[model samples]
Target: MQSTSNYLWLLKDILGQGATASVYKARRKQTGDHNAVKVFNHVSYLRPYEVQMREFDMLRKLNHKNIVKLLAVEEVGSTKQKVLVMEYCAGGSLLNVLEESENAFGLSESEFLIVLQSVVGGMNQLRENGVVHRDIKPGNIMRVVGEDGQSVYKLTDFGAARELEDDEQFMSLYGTEEYLHPDMYERAVLRKPQNKKYGVTVDLWSIGVTFYQTATGSLPFIPYGGPRKNKEMMHKITTEKPEGTIAGVQHRDCGPVEWSKELPITCRLSEGLKFLLVPILANILEADQAKCWGFDQFFAETNDILHRSVIHIFSLQQATVHKVYVHSYNTINVLMDAIFRQTGVPAVEQEFMYEGYYLELDLAQQVHLVPKTTEERPIILVSKEQKAPIGITYKEPDVPTFPPMFDLISDANLAKIVTCAVHQLLRITKSIMKCQDFILRGVYWMLAILKEECRKTLQRAATLNLKLDFCKSTMMRIQKIYGPHSRMNQSDGGDVHMKLQLTVHFLATISQNVQNSQKQLDQIAAQWSNTNDIHHKDSTIGKVEVLLEKVSAIHQQLKKDRMRMKLQYNDEQIHKFEKLNMGIHAKKVLALVREDCEQKYKKLLTCVKDWMRIACDIRKQLRSFGEQCESLHCDLENCEAYLNNMFHQIPLKLEGDQSTTKSTASTVYPDQKCMEMAIRMKQLKQEMEHVTKELQQNNMIIQSLSDGQKPQGV
Candidate 1:
């Protein structure tokens, strides 16, 4: 071949030949590397231009090791021949591999699986790109000798490939007659347009036939005829069962026999291996296209066969492996089935124990949890009544309930709320841990008591706090609690009472959730504080503030875009105006489309802005809440110190003064320094009460903001 652009080629002998193209081994003069060049005969093809274009389009988009790589596409000037330079496979085709290995032991199970996986991988890539590989067979599959001296199979021949369109039909009768699916074979015989219709399933049928050939070292269906015997081959493919023989040193069908027994390869395999492979192979050979296995199912079943893991079953009394080397894919239910076989235990009566915890029977099918690696924990089994070796209890969290307004808010807002809650909990726990246990408990109890009082205060304040600035007409009309009727009557009844009850109910639930959160935080803080391992303090509040700023900026831009794209007229107005147009229907369709686009655009923008606003408000409230916690921490430390000093000042009980202790207690009760400390503690408690009120006010504000209320001066 002559040089084209930068590439110069020295063509060797022909590698393979097809109806439209011929593959030849070529050496690049520039790189001194060998590659395969598929030169197409433009004049010979029925639609040569179309064939060249589709191949180029599909090849350019694909990049995978298993799929043949298209190095370059060049045109031979003067002559209308176009060549596609691809990665050369010195190992030749799989057909040659099977022929070479026929006398020397046929392909091993592992080798067969490797080739199948590579083919499946390449086919999946084509499927993802919306291109169907219409032809899949042994001759089309080429093998490259890798650096590791092992053969790597690649899929070639894109001339028959076609892009899938919506609800499209395959009308062309393409590919080899022997490997063609029965449906396609029938279509080819009839040569009728209506009879030709298929999907990607035809390729799978070809793979099934290819697998039988590669596995048994011979084609499943054979035709006995002279040259030009495609009709005979098609007849065998359409009528005969896809059968293979595995007699020693002989790779052809000996007689009519079951595939499992007749195939000598399966005779050497274990019962379990035969059991799995039989069903998979059967599904692949299904005559009904709808019933045939797709890529996902095939890959999954094949994966199970390739990647095997062992599980060890034992009793609770001792570490003795009863059943070893069980399949990892075998579910707990399967283990129960095994129990019936080994020990006559019913599946319902059987319960599995792993790592001192009883596994939920509902999650029995998830056998992948069993350790596959050497470093992973071993699988343990025990009876339902059996106790753990050591005393261990699992602490599962209670199922959470969403706030009433949860459904009304966007997911982004919900996320921000949870994030803020976590930050506040962390802040409080870290600060409180620095003080005495009594001080921490005292602070906790103080908050608990204050929360109850705050609820009452909020209920009273709800009636007077009717400063509605955000959507007043909508809120007043829907709720009607803070309307003129209630204000004039001075009676909290009907909707007013119901709304107040809901507010208090929500407040109480919030208080309980807060307490539960604080308890969890306390446990975590205590565990880490005892070990002195909490070196890094979280700056969550700072991070959230920065995030809020970025969100707000993005929200503003989306809002502007939404406003600009808004439709100029309403649907009714547009419909009326279109009556004057020459093509009224066309104009009406355009207007309707425009209206739909505008509505969607506005909704998307509104959603974004609402989330940003929620995030900003939550971050701001959490910051203030953190600062209050820090202040409370300081007051707690001071109060604890003062109380400690007061106790220290009191006289210690003497061993010899049991009778005199009563006298000392009475006399030292009103000591001047102790009185001063008591007065200071009283003042600190009063400060705590003020802090409580401020925190409650903040909570109310957060609730109002979440309810779409505008901020105002308290």
Candidate 2:
């Protein structure tokens, strides 16, 4: 007998009944649209039907494709059987698709991604509406093919969801057996304390199972024969891993490949799907819900694993450590006390030693300054009526107390201080001794380690002005070889170069911190830069005395290392080697500089001297050539007079001894001789032209070499 209906009359279409609920295929009479209706026996549940009906209202309001819409609800007569009529899927649920693929025992990697996006989208919407669907599974998912050939997944049923609290706490339990979180399973089986409260992480567990099925096509845990029988079989499903004894079955031992010989159903999935899931998967699954994680924790833990994996993959880029025996302060005497009866290295336990010691010291010292339960010793109240007036009520003066011997300056604090100093000194000593390294950073091997150590100590330990002498020397070493043609110091170029500026900054920051600490001391030691002023403003000589003692201790350690150096190896030998090294270093630099300087100086000096001498010699050559030209002009005139006299004499002889044709003979003689002379004149002109060409060529030769200057002449 169904009592009320959200829709006017759709409840009459009951088509079937199952072990848990009744189902029907109904048509919305108003729109002629088909839908599936489910009737639940909400009568015997802890929550009332109204709670589920309200969730149905929320679903009905949503209009996303990937969400199942609750169209209407019908409530049964007083027994409170609630009914939900929801949108119908044509092809069926994703569970059927997984069972029907070609190689399709499971969804392929690509198909899984599409389905995952849909599922996550629906859940994200639910979350935005301030809800957590405590139950999520393949059965809860319905897939429909769109006209666009795309597969759509819809999430349904939020009966057990809870709204989160302001304090970030959520608790809920409702889902199918295979997808139920370990936390909810505990809540079902155990009475109370055994089932701890959990949060949205429960939804994540279901999501993990969903992803596993989506990828590999099968549930990681499938104990059959209904939820109760499955619950019995869960001891194996949840607790017993396929690997080994139950000790640490949840956490697998990593190997080179880090894959198990037997694969999880998820492992059988495609590689692309595995990649999509890995960044979000928490490495270990635990029955203890507290150890499980929400999304952020899942991301953090996965990132940590991924980072370590990268370091292992590219081990060459990361820092390498050797298995050397470095001395630690774990004394055998301190190891005898066991906090619990366990067997392991007591390193974390040893930390408690310092904590306990400091705590005890604090308690003891505070007792001296501040009283605790004074009546346990003695109590006498002064009365005004008896011995004295109220202001002077004490008849007898009480004894004044002074600080105890060790209370003034604690050895534990001093020890802590000394331990730090010892480690720091050891670092510097190692750096200083490796002079052959001459790397600017104390010792190059310890460079990164020391810098990080100093940074932590200064920043975390509140230490000021640690020694940076080694860092300074390291920079100088770099500066010494900074020029061209300098030999490389380290194999890795400038990356690890420990840039001098960075080193200086580290040292300078340290120095500033030290100066600041000194100012803090000045608060006590104000106006007392020198000794003998022991007023309230200045530190007492006694305190100064203790500081001097610590300084002396540091000095003593340095002296001991020096002696150790000598006794272990001869001082003279080390001194000689150091001197020889320094000399070789200076000599190499000097030789390179000297050679370069000498060559350049000689070249420049020679060029200058040659130019000076050539300047004067050029003037003298010009004067001499001018004089030669004048003498050649005079010789040419004398030659012309001799040729004229010869011509006149020859004509007179021809006139006296020849036939009576004197004028004609003269004309004929003149023509014959002139022709002969014309031949000779042509020859002379050729000779003059040849000589002129020779002169021009000589002048060009002089002009070319004239640019080349002469050395100073004698």
Candidate 3:
């Protein structure tokens, strides 16, 4: 795809070719430095150019050592070609390295770990930037040889990469069949709608399969198959057991099928390494996305298994045992110094022992790791004169040094608090539902009491309508039930007239007190309801209810006007005018008392209605406060400051009043003082109203008696 040019780069021999492009070893014309150029033919190679440009854009944004660097993109007009210049990797691809080794089985365990760590580091970086490399296989990982003849692996090939938005799902199926996650296979081949959407978890599955193949020199699941065999392979990938070979089987739909025999990877690994890889593989290969290992979780598990390991060091001269925790990646000199501090010996004088032989100090100092036996056992340390022991046994002791306070502090951020608050709110909401149920029961109790009062009032009114003889008989029957202690007795200066006057005055006083207290409760309930409505303006339920209430009010006003007009034009009218007469008979006084009792019961009903409404309003206020607090807690930086300021502003204590038995069951006010003062003020006002109403009723009764007629019916 290149023409003769003397500009920046001079193209040389072709290195590799793909379906869309070819990579060539090129040298810089000015500096004579080597680099690789991926040339794309503008005619057919760059077909549907959007996808190609997306890959280029992703390459330009990536800037990590483990990720390949893109130097420049050049467009040659004469040749109709586009070329991308990238960092030169002299050691070729990791797949080539694996293939070059005999049967891909010569890679040492240490080298495999190095490769895995580098790839994982790169993948983690990509994830942090919201880029998912959907295609992650061995061929995409390239090895770059440094000036010192050591090689470092870097991830390449971003053709299948995608940038994801927050919480977004990637639905396209485009990865290698051999390395495809089982879910991806289900979407691409089986065309399953349920498996249509997946995310970055698929990348981990590819890496797991690639790791399995690299370690055992065989694919975990075979890639070759006909239609019937393909179905069998798909089923095997989806539901196969972990510790078994994936081989072709003779299906009923297909004739006898045969495949090559391959040893399971676990069989080839040492027991210790197998223990480490087994769990990692299980997590990575999990079919459920919810259970799959995240990048941080997977790395933490890997470090605990492979890097952070404990060893028992037996001291022969001092006759003491010390436990040493070692990181496998740390240099042996570091391990030796750790052992020296634990045993009170100098590093230079310490000699280490393995299974059957002593380690040379010169070799130990230069090595990067504390040597382990093939079985991965702990190493032993002894003085120069002491002989090595045959058996070693020691218990793990507690660490002598505690961590610094700053290090002990956990780094839980706002996001974690948000998650915890969600669960806490769920529990609180359930408790609130139970409280509401109890309140409903209370409402029903009040209704039952009111119903019984209404039934008694109706019976009393019916008895009043009966003949005068029946009324006398009923009064005698009531006296018979209560004997001489009945209040109806005219003896002992408690006649029916006096008792009736006292009863009307008492009923009036109670009604006034109830009405005043009900007004206070209504005021408080309205204030809280208004605040809740303002706070929840964005809520759909609140808005819809408000609209419905306005509509109902207008409809009621129209209905009232129409009924008023109809009554104005009626042919007949009913009217009753009561004139107070001072002359009161004993029978009429009893009737007055009965009517007063009914009015008192009606006032009690109004008090109960007001209390129920206030209770509901307070509940709504508490629910609103909880929702707001939950939102504030998510903003961790300002949550504590805001709450502290609110606390300082609210009045906390009442003046010169201390009573521990104050009712706190109604509302959750900012402080006890606010509730206490409000209740005390309402109680004082109610007492004054009660006294005033009693005096007024007594004056009206006296005036009616002064006029020489009975008082008006209550």
Candidate 4:
């Protein structure tokens, strides 16, 4: 092939091929610079000479960055065949980019904005030049990567293009079937042979189809097979407006329309962008040319979207969602500052995460350019500091004083006095010991049960965390092996990975809390055991026992003194001696024992109050752990189901793509680790229920003691 500049062009590779011509990746011999060359076949030469020169004339008249530049027009050296040389677009057509697995659903919001801007700019250039690109589709749009790594789409393949004002009409049938207008489809595809004259509004219909497909990865209108096989049905669905029929879709030939004004659920664009885009789609997708939007309105609406502030939703540790408005030019630092202001977390302590990766504060990183999807979880802002634990306080009950000791000397009958005093002392000592023993044993049992539950709960949480880690590693490996274009590298995969990470982190936190509770239980158990030993040796109950023995000995001595006075002395002498020795000694000893018992009983009350406080703490800890376990259980279930669905979808997605590797089969089934986690979750739930019942019983025991009622054993 030869160019008009006398430069020899070597066709190194075929870039693309169409019905009339084939494009090649050609290199100039002198400069060795790559360029795209279009070589038309003999079929194209059969057209009228003026029709053959139309594309060249259109390209020479248009000069815009969004339109592909025409380099040189040449001829084949042997066959005198005409050839067109155009500037090379390294990024290729937009269709090839959309064919990747990651974009099977749609382009991300940021990426969609780029396409919108580029296409609108190109169309505006066409309007200014009075040119109509009769064949406007994804295949005709070329992508060029700029120096800053940004994509710019340009219009190419202008073979069917011509100069026509908006009001002018041309009776030409050209364009792909799916993107064609209903009137054009009737004539060109259905072979109905209608003489309908097409105007500039036909391009608007094509733009609407292309835009919808770019945003949602599927065509808007539909029939049973496709536009080719179901020609009449496709034309009717696009043009007819029954009483209850929607515009874009129908279930069957006479079935009700199933279209909605909102975008499909599979679209990844945000609700904010959807709000702006739907109105535009509704106006331009109209089959009636009179109702469709003109180029002026289209440019105005698209430009408005480009200049508006970006909206982002952030969640603070999965607790609260905050809506923030950011300009397109703002940096990540500014976004972090905004989060700090809204969440009250210090900027230095805040860690922002989008998808599964932490966001860095790079100067060149725009806040609005983060790769996020509507179906994915919100951006998470986590605090570096630990939250304070929830706590409950209890008021200590007032101590009780020992009852007044009986005055034996005041009683006229000596035998009765001894019996009453000895009986009262024995009863008091037995009651005190029994109450102490009951409280000690009850508290010890509760502590032991709580400790055991903590241990079991921690073990289950550890197991679940391990399973989560395994699943996450497997997902990461799949992404690595598939490269960036695979379905595993999309935003959905990031969402799954982020959810798994969150579950694992939560399990680790709960495990740490359970361990802390166990330590507290151990401390309470050790303290109760020490108190039990003291009860047997030097506690208030032991002191009461010693006092009972002393009282008995005093009573016996009094009886002996009474017998001696009756046998060996006169009445007056006996009365005087009894008053001086027996009465004084009995009163002094009884007063001392009563004082000692009162002090010991007060110490015992303090100890029991301490135990009550410790028990309340344990109950609070148990309740907290149970709640954490419930949350972890829910997270694990969601993560498991999401992973299972992802695994099932892998094989189906791979079947459509011939370029995928065979290793993807390894991850196409549900993992055993998720099932193991499910089993552990069930066991953990049962343990939680058992612990709850034990806690209720413990509360009852504590409440009874607080009311000063005797325990069952006592």
Cα misplacement distance, residue 173 of candidate 3 (Å) = 2.5
TM-score of 3: 0.42
lDDT per residue for candidate 3 within 485-562, as digits (tens), equals 744354621443343344335334434433444454456445434433432342322332333343333333333444
Who is ahead in lDDT, 1 or 2?
1
Question: Which consecutive 10 residues in model 1 have the weakest lDDT in total?
Answer: 390-399
Better candidate by lDDT, 1 or 4: 4
Clashing pairs in 4: none
Report the Cα lDDT for candidate 2: 0.42
Candidate 2: the clashing residue pairs are 3-77, 101-104, 440-474, 441-474, 610-709, 610-710
Q: Best-fitting candidate, measured by TM-score?
A: 4
lDDT, candidate 2, 368-445, per-residue tens: 221221111111111111111111000111111222232212322333233333332322222222211111111121
Model 1 lDDT tens row, 363-404: 367456654422123333433332222111112111122333
Segments of candidate 3 deviating more than 4 angstroms: 1-12, 42-49, 77-80, 189-195, 223-232, 239-270, 303-714
Those runs of model 2 whose alpha carbons end farther than 4 Å from true positions after fitting are: 1-20, 42-46, 49-54, 60-63, 74-82, 101-104, 165-172, 189-195, 222-233, 236-269, 283-291, 296-714
Candidate lDDT (C-alpha), each: 0.51, 0.42, 0.52, 0.66
- Residue 325 in model 3: lDDT: 53
Report the error of model 3 at residue 199, Å: 0.4
- State TM-scores per candidate: 0.42, 0.36, 0.42, 0.46
**What lDDT does candidate 3 reach at residue 258?**
41
Q: Model 2 reaches what TM-score against the true structure?
A: 0.36
